[model samples]
Target: MALGMLKKKRDSKMSTDQENENEQNGNQQNGNQQNGNGEDKEKQGGGPPKPVGFLDPRMKHVRRSVAGKWLLTTVVLMIFILGVLSIYWACLFHVDQNLSSLVVYVVDFDGQVAPYNTSGVTPLVGPMITDMARSMVASNEPTLGWGPLPPSAFDYDPIKVRQAVYDFDAWAAIIINPNATALLYSAVQNGNTSYDPLGALQLVYIDSRDDTIWYDFMAPFMSSFMTNAQSSIGSAWTRQILQAASTNTTLLSNIAAVPQALSPAIGFSEYNLRPFYPYQVIPAVTVGLIYLIILSFFSFAFYLPVWMQYLKPEGHPPLKFHQLVVVRWCGTILAYLFLSLAYSLISLAFQINFSGGNPVSSSTEVTSTVDGNLNPDAYGKGTFPVYWMLNFVGMIALGLACENVAMVVGQPWTGLWLIFWVITNVSTSFYDITIEPRFYYWGYAWPLHSVVEGSRHILFGLHSRIGLDFGILIAWAAVNTALFPFAFMFMMYKNKHHLHEYWA
Candidate 1:
């Protein structure tokens, strides 16, 4: 009976101890669950994590890696320094130095099929003009290279001549009229020293689009050439006229005796194709406005995806990557289109006509100084709506290109900013690249260059490469659009595999 009572007591004690241990374990597990919930709430409800300096939390991997930090610093420094140097100092230097290398189109239509006089005297003016250009090169001063066009080029009308200038084949073109020699010879033969009978020397030049650069460095170059040409022509003409006068007493008494009428045989007249709207410097304004649209479009395209990711609510259906891409394209186009439309409206309200035309009629009375042709139908019809629409298309292309760059770099803000700065430097907005060392022309292939060039053509009546410009813009847009999806997928793969963990 004693042994049975002892066994019962021991079993009851063992059962109580086992129950206590189980209860303690259960309580500890509940406490751990509550703590985990608290931590998760802090992470989810508290908003974005704090940034480390200028970098976001997502960029933590790059911040930690030494090589990555070095690369970032170097790139930032390089961009800052290079952009400043290229835009400000290098451009100024190039404009000052490389002007001598430019070619001036010398289309001499003044050549007489036969001698201008009955005395068997050929004018020989063309050789004289060419000799003067060659002499300039020998002098070692910044001089022009005379590029003689074919005789058939003389038959090209005013519109074709303007198109040639727009194509950048010539800094300036001199279309010597048939009157150059014939009229001068008549004055000498008639012994009429009353006024210059040869008429004014017409210089066809495009005006400066900007205040600083002076028409892609055309002003300085043409100015120098004109000075040299005038001097050479005066000296040669004096010698020729005096020689003729010495032979004929009547001609000598009328011209050689009268020193006051010994002025230059040719009066200079400059005819600018892009005349301003009364007084405003609006050609550059158009360029600035277009660039602003591009910048705005880029800002919108770059930030929209990130904003969508962050601002979207929890219950809302998660946007697919493809959906994001579609949104990007549509949003970019709409944003730029609105911007362009707004500018067009403002321009219209102010009567700021980019396309040179009279408000009342499509055609205006314009007298041609070159050929002295008078036509009532001198102007083409103004097309404002077409230009505005094209501006919208161009803006979309620029935005798409910027977005593609952002996707490839995996950082929207930084990538686009750097790209803009670089493009601005390359653009002739600040400096003419023709003046640059080695004549750097890589930027000519860029969309912005095409847009600026095309816009000038639109503003003026030169429709030389309008089709080519739009084609380039569309091609670039397509290339960028195709690149975006691939870049996004590659970036996602890297993130998933933690491949960028070392240096994101």
Candidate 2:
């Protein structure tokens, strides 16, 4: 019984040890499986799963849905860039093709029929000037189109000529003094220095705002005209003097009979009606920079709320539509004022001074005397404040319009379209909208063009259409301001209807 009892105890102890070993082995296997799973998960989530190339191969929809969005954006941007380039080239081509169609006005104050005229014709020298101008402009060699103003346009007054130029009746004024012939004859025959060729010269008043007209057309044509006239007059006078010195009465009488042959007398002067201010680049660059700033401001304003909502979830409730409008107006006014102040300082750096007073001459007299020519001058005195105010209001209107566009579009991409519009309207910068192609003529309605025109009118004393421009700008501002509330309502409706699914 003792041996049997000892054997039972040994068997029971061996059985217990075997069970313990089995449990240890199972636990080790389970731990190994868990480690393997953890390593697999790390590899899948944190490491590159495949070789890098154009796109990842392991992702759902090529890593994420945003990848598709990125691809679409790249393609669309490339297309837009190409389209903008094509439009710019088209504008250049348009300008090149239509240059000959530009019209100019001719004022012939240089009327003198001639001394010893035989046919009992009026010795008005204006007809001669007009005829010569017409003949030149009618040529097929890409000359500017010339239109001769009637004598009824002005009564031989130099001040009236300046006023006409200011009123945009013509691009330039050509004035021939009443005694132009007499002065030329005296200068040639008696070597009289009183009729200084340059001082007592025929007067040409030009709008110097556009260098193309002055340098390309007026300067060249007038120079050649003067040279030819002087040569012809000098030759005729020399022939007559030689004949008179030889006591050749028959030859002298013959020459005197053709005294009208000396009608190509030369003496001319030019007055720049709106002289190019030395710092014209300042105004131009200022406008462009301000436009860019306004654009950036509107773009930022549009997105800032979204960013705020994300970053400051508990900071404040969503801004109300009226609050947003008020904020935008205040921001726009402040931004424009700051930028304008900076622009004024920049102008001073370039020595561009602005003053206040009447820009036009007090006297409206046209005198044949040398000192009596009307002052072809620029008046920027009282005009600066008007121009600055117009530009300020214009910028504000443009900003509000852009902001309204962003709100109505309700897409971040509206910023890109706004940029495209601004670039396209730049055709107004170099060429007059009237001369630009039909495609670009829409720039006349653009807000920036009105601002540029108003600036030019006040700065350079152009024929100002400020009132019309102001009306347009104010109308745009008012309409856009009214549209903002509607845009907010639409955005709210969209968020409630379309975006609710994502929130849910």
- The global C-alpha lDDT for each of the candidates, from Candidate 1 onward, is 0.56, 0.56
Model 1: per-residue Cα lDDT at residue 352: 44
lDDT tens digits by residue: candidate 1, 193-308: 56562352556654533324455455666676667766666677778888877778888766754442345665445655444333332542344644544575457555655645
Instruction: Supply every candidate's count of residue pairs whose N, Cα or C atoms clash at under 3 angstroms.
Output: 0, 13
TM-score versus the correct structure, for each prediction:
0.66, 0.70
lDDT of 1: 0.56
- Which sections of candidate 2 miss by over 4 Å? 1-40, 43-75, 112-128, 188-191, 199-203, 206-208, 211-265, 280-319, 357-384, 408-415, 488-504
Candidate 1 clash pair list = none
Model 1 compared with the native: what TM-score?
Answer: 0.66
Backbone clashes, candidate 1? 0
In candidate 2, how many Å is residue 438 off?
3.0
